[model samples]
Target: MASIRRLVLDVLKPVEVATVSFARELSDLDGVDATAVRLVETDREVQNVTLVVEGEAVDFERVEACIESLGGTLHSVDEVVCGEFVPEEHVAHADATWLR
Candidate 1:
């Protein structure tokens, strides 16, 4: 089976909890090496967030459960990286080249 090494998710969550707290909680799960959550947009009661999770083999079911437990709704899976050995992208220059 191909191991899930990276995942990018779009989530909608209540504002009561902090994104860092969610990241910390996700990082505590099995196989999760790290997590990064960024606020994309916000309304009065909820925040739209983009979540990036990295692991040797990410348990997606557990991750979804964790999100629900934290009062978050999974919107969509934007990106995913999975394989026995996933290659990392390295950029020589720090510029918005991809955007141009």
Candidate 2:
């Protein structure tokens, strides 16, 4: 079986609920599922919201569009760092230094 990696999307919007609704619509996509949905809170007004989605990368673009169509605009996408999907490997040392 093939394993899909996490796709991280950064979106900017006017309201928090708007972003949540966009994420909700993503769950209903043909091959998209939400492993996790996180909203980072800050005192500063939210100009950017990050959504981390776990699934096949093949469907990433379509899902991205769905998010945009739902009135949320995607600002950037970062491929999750994991062996199965992204080629890079992240390593932690005993001293807490990280290597990728």
Candidate 3:
């Protein structure tokens, strides 16, 4: 099976946990190499965040568990990359309606 190389998740987290701490904990996961947490939206009780995680073989279960432990809910898996290599993203040309 191909290894999971990257994951982009939409998460909702309690404001109590700082983004820095949440990102740091994700980066510390066994198979994770790095993490990028972007604040998408926020309210008095929760924050909507986009979490990007990259690694040689990211463990989705562990990532999900960590988020839950930190009072977060996984809203959706926005993106996922699984293979021996991570593919570069390409922008669709204006004339390429089919690609879009």
Highest-scoring model, lDDT: 3
Question: Residue 23 CA error for candidate 3 (Å)?
Answer: 0.6
* Clashes per model (N, Cα, C within 3 A): 0, 0, 0
Runs off by more than 4 Å, candidate 3: 90-100
Off by over 4 Å in 2: 1-4, 41-47, 56-58, 80-89, 92-100
Stretches of model 1 off by over 4 angstroms after superposition: 85-100
Query: CA shift at 45, candidate 1, in angstroms?
Result: 0.2
Q: How well does candidate 1 score on lDDT at residue 50?
A: 96
Q: Give each model's whole-structure lDDT.
A: 0.93, 0.62, 0.95
**Per-residue lDDT for 25-59 in model 1, tens only?**
99999999999999999998999999999999999
RMSD of candidates 1 onward, in order? 4.6, 5.1, 2.6
Instruction: Evaluate model 3: give its lDDT.
Output: 0.95
Candidate 3, residue 52: CA error in Å?
A: 0.4
Candidate 2 — which pairs collide? Answer: none
User: Model 2 residue 4 lDDT?
Assistant: 50
Q: Give me the displacement of residue 21 in model 3, in angstroms.
A: 1.7
